[model samples]
Target: MNDKENRSRSRNETSTRTGMGASRPSRRIVAGHTRPCAECGLVDWKLDDSRGEVSCNSCGLVVEENVIDPGAEWTNHANTGVDRSRVGAPITHTLADKGLNTSIAASDLTSGGASRNGISARSRREWRRRRVIDERSKTRQSKIRNRVKAFQYIRDRSQLPSSLKEEACRIYGMLSDEGFVTGRSIAGVTAACTYLVARKEGIPRQIPDLAEKFHVGEKELSRLIRGVSRRFNMHTITLPPQFFPKFVSDLELPPETMMALDGLWNTIEPHTDIWQGKKPMGVAAALIYKAAAEGGTRRTQSDICKVANVSEVTLRGLIKQIDGLLKSIGSPSA
Candidate 1:
C-alpha cells in the first residue's frame, strides 16, 4: 500500500475508535450473562477490566483476583456464600411466566437507591439486623415505663382517713427508686396501696374482692396488709358477742372487783330465801353494799324499799347483813 494511503487509513481507524468525549472510555456494555460465585452465592457478575477482580454484589466478596474462566465448581466451595465474582451474570431481572420478578433485588422497591441492586442489597441486610436490636431496646424501655406509671396510678388512687396521699407518694418513691425496676405491676401496687389506706383509716375491705380487683393472690395481699400495719403501728382487734369481759379486762380492774360485780347480784338472789316480807331485794342489796364500801349513796334504803315493794324492816335487815359480810370479808374497799 502507498504511504499516503496507509496514513489516511490509520487516521480513519483512530477517529472511528475515539468516543464523543476525547479520550474517555465508552459506557460499560453488559453481556447479559450470569454465573453463581463459588465463594459467595451471588448469581450476578459485572466485569471490571482494570483490576482483574470479580466482585459479587450480593455478599461483596472478591471471587477472582487474577484468574480467567474462574473454574467450574467455583460455586461449590466453603466460600460460595461469600464470593464477590463479577462475571457472566444477567444484568437485569426478568419476570417468569407468572409475571412476577421474584428477584433478589426486592430491597430496591423499599429503598430507591442509585445503584438500585447493589445498595439496596447491602442496606436491607444491615437495616434488618439493626431493626431487630432496636425493637428489643424499645420493648425493654416500654416495660420499664409502664411499671413506673402503674405505681403512680396507685399512689393517686389511694384513699386513707389521714394524710394517706402523702404516705402513698412516699411509698411509691421508695419502691420506684430503691426497689427493683420492674419488680411490681400496676394491679399489685394498687392492691397494696388500697389495703394500706384502709388499714390506716380503720376501714375494713373484703380481702377476696381486693385481691381480685388488684390481680393479686390472697397470700400476697395478706403480706402487704401486714407490712402496712407494721409500718403504721396500728392495732387491730375483733370484738366477740360477749364483749363485756374484754372491756372489763382492758380496764385493768382488780380480779376480785370483777368477780364481785359479776356474782354480787346472783348471791343476793339465793339469800332471798331467808328474807321475809316483800323486799326490794335487788336494789336494796346493790345500794347498801355500794354505800358502805364506796362511802357514798345516791339512794337510801327507804327509797329502795319503796321501789322494790319491800317493807323497811326487811330492807334494813338485808342491808345490815350485807354490811356485816363485807366487813368480815375484809374487802379492799372496806
Candidate 2:
C-alpha cells in the first residue's frame, strides 16, 4: 500500500514538472522499441519533446534527459509558420569590393527622415560629406580604380548575360591582380576575358563583334586570347563545331537541321587533314548553311555569313574544302 502511494506521488510530480499544456489526452506510443526501464520492467516510455525528456510511464523515472534535436530551433515557429533564415547575403566576385559595400541612401537625409530622427540641417550636411568621402575611399587605390573601370565597362558596354558578366569580371580581376593584365589596355583585357568566357562556356561570340562592342582593337584582343590560354595552360584547340549551336539558333534551324548537323560533323570529323587550317567561324557558317539547305530550310550564304561575321569568300573557301572532303569520303548525302 505504501509503495503504491509513493508511485502515485512520483507520477503526479513528473506530470507537473513536464508542463505540456493541453497537448493531447492520448499517450504517445513508445512501447517495444527501447529496453525496459530500470525502475519498472515496462517498455512504456513517455517522450516529452517540449521538455526534451524520456521517462518511464509506470514509475515516472526519467530514462533520458536533454536530448538533442536536429531540426530548426523551436520558438514561436509552430504558432506563426514561416522560415526565418538566419544568414546574410551571398558573397560575389563581381565588384572591386566583392559585395561588401554599404550605401547610405540620400533620401535618408530628406526632410521626413530628419524630422523623424530629430536631425538638424547641419547634421545632414555633415553626413553627406562623410558619404562622399566613403565613396571616394572605395576607389582610393590605383588597382581598385582599374578594377572599377573594367567592371563598369563590362556592365555598361558588353552584350553578355548578367551571369556571364560576373564570370568575365571575375576573370579580369584575377588576371589584373596577377600582372597578366599589366602593361595591357584595360578595355582590351576586359574584352578578351569576355570573349574567352563566352567561348569556353560554348556561347560562340565573334571576336570582331566583341572588339567593336568593347571598343578595343581586334588584333590586340586576339593576341591576348592566345596569351590568356597559355597562362591557364588550356591547350585544347577551339574547333568549328563548337560554334554550331549558337549559329544555328540565330538562323532558327529546325529540329531536323540540328540532327543533320550531328551526322554532317560525323562525316567531316574523319577528314581532319582537310579542315585543319580553316577559320572556325567561316567553317561553322558553311556547314550550317549546307545542313539547313539539306533539311529544306535553305538559309542564304549571305545571311549565314552576316550572322557569323565571316566574309562570303571565307565561307565559300570552307565550303569548297567541305566539297573535297565529301568527294573523298564518298558521302551520298553530300
Per-residue CA lDDT of model 1 for 280-302, tens digit only, reads: 33343433335434533234555
Which one is best on lDDT? 2
Model 2 C-alpha lDDT per residue in residues 174-246, reported as the tens digit of each score: 8987988778889988887887887777775788888898788889989987888778764456788888888
Instruction: Quote the lDDT for 269 in model 2.
Output: 81
Per-model C-alpha lDDT, please?
A: 0.48, 0.78
The global Cα lDDT (0 to 1) of model 1 is 0.48
User: What clash count goes with each model?
Assistant: 21, 0
Candidate 2 worst ten-residue window by lDDT = 23-32
For model 2, the stretches where C-alpha displacement exceeds 4 angstroms are 1-85, 105-129, 156-163
